[model samples]
Target: MRNKSIKKLNNKMNSKKVIVTFLILVCTIFNIGAQNITPDSKVLYKKVNGDSLYLHLFKPEISKKPTAAIVFFFGGGWVGGNPKQFYQQSKYFASRGILAISAEYRVKNTHGTSPFECVEDGKSAIRWVRENAKELNIDPNKIVASGGSAGGHVALTTALIKGLENVDENLSVSSVPNAVVAYNPVSDTTLKGYGSKKVVGRETEISPTDQVKKDMPPMLIFHGTKDKTVPFENAERFTRLMKEAGNDCELVAVDNMGHGFFNGDFFRKGTGNKYFNLTAYKTDVFLEKLCYLKEKPTLAENIKQVSCIGDSNTEATYPKFLQEKLGENYQVKNFGKGGATLIEGTNHPYFKKKEYKNSLKFTPDIVLIMFGTNDANVKWCLDKTRKTKFIGTPQEEFKSQYIKLINTYKRKNENAEIYVLTPLPIYEHAKSRDPEIKKRIKHLYDWVIPIIREIAEEQNVKLIDVNKLMKKAYKYTVDGIHLNQKGYKILAKKIAKEIK
Candidate 1:
């Protein structure tokens, strides 16, 4: 009888010890003051391997409805990297009405963890987001995963390679994201690939390229052909396999760009990272295509901002002339990008450039839009002809995008005056620098110019005919497409007089 009593006493004491230990661990691992934590912060999200993982969030300024979300992981070959790698990205996506998060994971240098732990943490972060979606005001089904290099591999793995999830995480909620966007990811961790060394024995298990399956979510990849670190071929191989498995994957091969090409350059140099801004814009396009965003962006703060929007011609020469004439009080700034077509979905859409966003941010009293030069380039688009770099056609995309761009400015300032300019006549000749421009000069006048006129008439806005003004001034063209300084001066003088 005494022995039975002792056994019961021992069992009860052991149960109490276990409960006390569990309580101590809970106290150490979980943030007791979680309510005091910021809305999107270094949240002690995942508890594993006796460590806590954090993720920072950038939520929409006004969350009127449940919104889509994107989570970013930073890359450092599993040795290092932090959440801040995508800080600018998160902020940009947030401004566009999506919940953006930059997640922290176990890295080799910091956590003495393997790639397996990284994957586990990555999965946990996604699971956490879904688990708390109602409170975060996020639509659980519209989550997207994106990252650069190794971080990209982690994001990709969340969709492709599975089963490395943390045991404590809720498995009922999917770790898989609805869409994936990778920037020069170390996607293939096979023995033949660069990242294979990091995972060592478990390369095949974590390799996204090896795990391609049907019914996978849509994916967008921007990999530089010149990327020597991960080899542009890795992304191509993964994309090829993904397609073969009947998955929707779009690979944007960036020519002559190296690894980490999407990183913002502000910290390195004072100038904004054009590459970062462009990629972020492209991501926005991708999400919009999926109908995932809560709403389109609108309005901003400003001064006596005069935003000059256009293609390469407007980039430096003519905008400089306009700026010089306007003087300091007008604050005329050129937000033009080379090879920019106003049509959306093209490789070089004006909407994809940082200049476009900056122009809107300028909150100008007067807006000058000088496009149609690139839009008229015959080889660019002809209803999915597969010959051009642009994804939009002049007929379907030009007029609508023009109206949208105009409305975007008006939203910023209802009183803002906008003027549309017709492109100069293409002078194809021996001196023309661009062969395509010379060869396809006919399209500009035949179709693009007439369309610009139609939009100017229908939209009931001010029209400035730079082309008709210089129809006989072909000799002033530096290229068949772009104008020389003398031609720009004529344009500037004309614009200055009209606006005045």
Candidate 2:
């Protein structure tokens, strides 16, 4: 009886031990998942209203020394807005090897403050970022100020306007960013533009467009043509003034779109993703151009990739030259198949090829599309039978198809920077191949190149004017249609200039 009691007690204790171990494992897993899902954030300042303003920080898992940083302010017309508005953008920049921050500032709803106070807080946040650059492991010189709508005004104020500095901030530390990315910003606060009533006494004090300076940071602005709250002309006027002042500013006007179109949440769930994705992708390209980011975008394990999609031209030697030019920092893959057309069900359709599938699988950070050479073939475009099978006119079909291709890659990787390449021009002699080839050359120059240019413009993706560049080097091509080694070298140089 004594031995039986002892064995029973031992079994009960062992059961308790197992239960405890399992519970501990479950808790550990949950904790790790929570950490991964939630980013690290901290309070940067405490206001007189007893509310703490926090900076939600998203630091890259892997970063090179002296990392670049981008700070975003939320838009709410100085009435109300949440730092969460830019969380997605911050997360994206963090993944690209930059320290990204979404800062909370004083707003009318919580602090009962005016736009001027908001501007002061904006400057303080930037100053804090600059002051703590060492602690944040970021390069102060590469800081980028970014925001949307009212918040965009704050961002611009950091660069263009002055005198709204916080008393506690170190005046020696500059709040101005090396670059700016603004979305539908209320750039003009005068009587003609947004927030005119709010800035009644001090119109020019907060008007970014009115304060354009010669040495302001390079800026990229995204605005909708149909925005009512902030007129589309505001963006145009601001960019024009910046350019006139000898500053670089790029304005991307989204057609038929309205206010707050840059934000995904502005539309119904899953509806406005395209606008958000394109804007984010363009910002990445702009940052890369400024040399703020490394040559290639940082992916998991520090790997970066570039996927080139096209026809014989991309397949021959350009990809190799690109690989050499990019050096060891990138995995350059040529997904080019010979005699491939951009259109589906065409002779040697590229969309149906394995290279296309491979390119999608690669999940590249940068995609270069150079198609249209084969699609412009006279037999493909002018054939009555083929034309009958096509979904629309050659130009319409081409535009829709190119947009489809861009959206496909964008869906695969929203961060990828897609570049559309114009088909290279054929030399005058190469046009003599046959009646069909001569007609193809004419179609390429007359119909195809213009169609691609229109698509690029409409889609708002960067266009590489390969036709224009190749025209200058047509002498390097042996047959006018295909480029020789010398021609490939020139092509590579131009591509490198654009991408690198």
Q: What is the per-residue lDDT of model 1 for residues 387-479, given as tens digits with 9 covering 90 to 100?
A: 334344556577778888888998876878888988877876677655676435677777777787888888777898988877877777665
lDDT agreement with native, every candidate: 0.73, 0.76
Number of backbone-clashing residue pairs for each candidate, in the order shown: 1, 0
| Residue 45, candidate 2: C-alpha displacement in angstroms | 3.7
Cα error, candidate 1, residue 76 (Å): 0.9
Weakest ten-residue segment in model 2 by summed lDDT:
26-35
Best-matching candidate per TM-score: 1
Give the 10-residue window scoring lowest on summed lDDT in candidate 1. 28-37
TM-score of each: 0.54, 0.53
List of clashing residue pairs for candidate 2: none
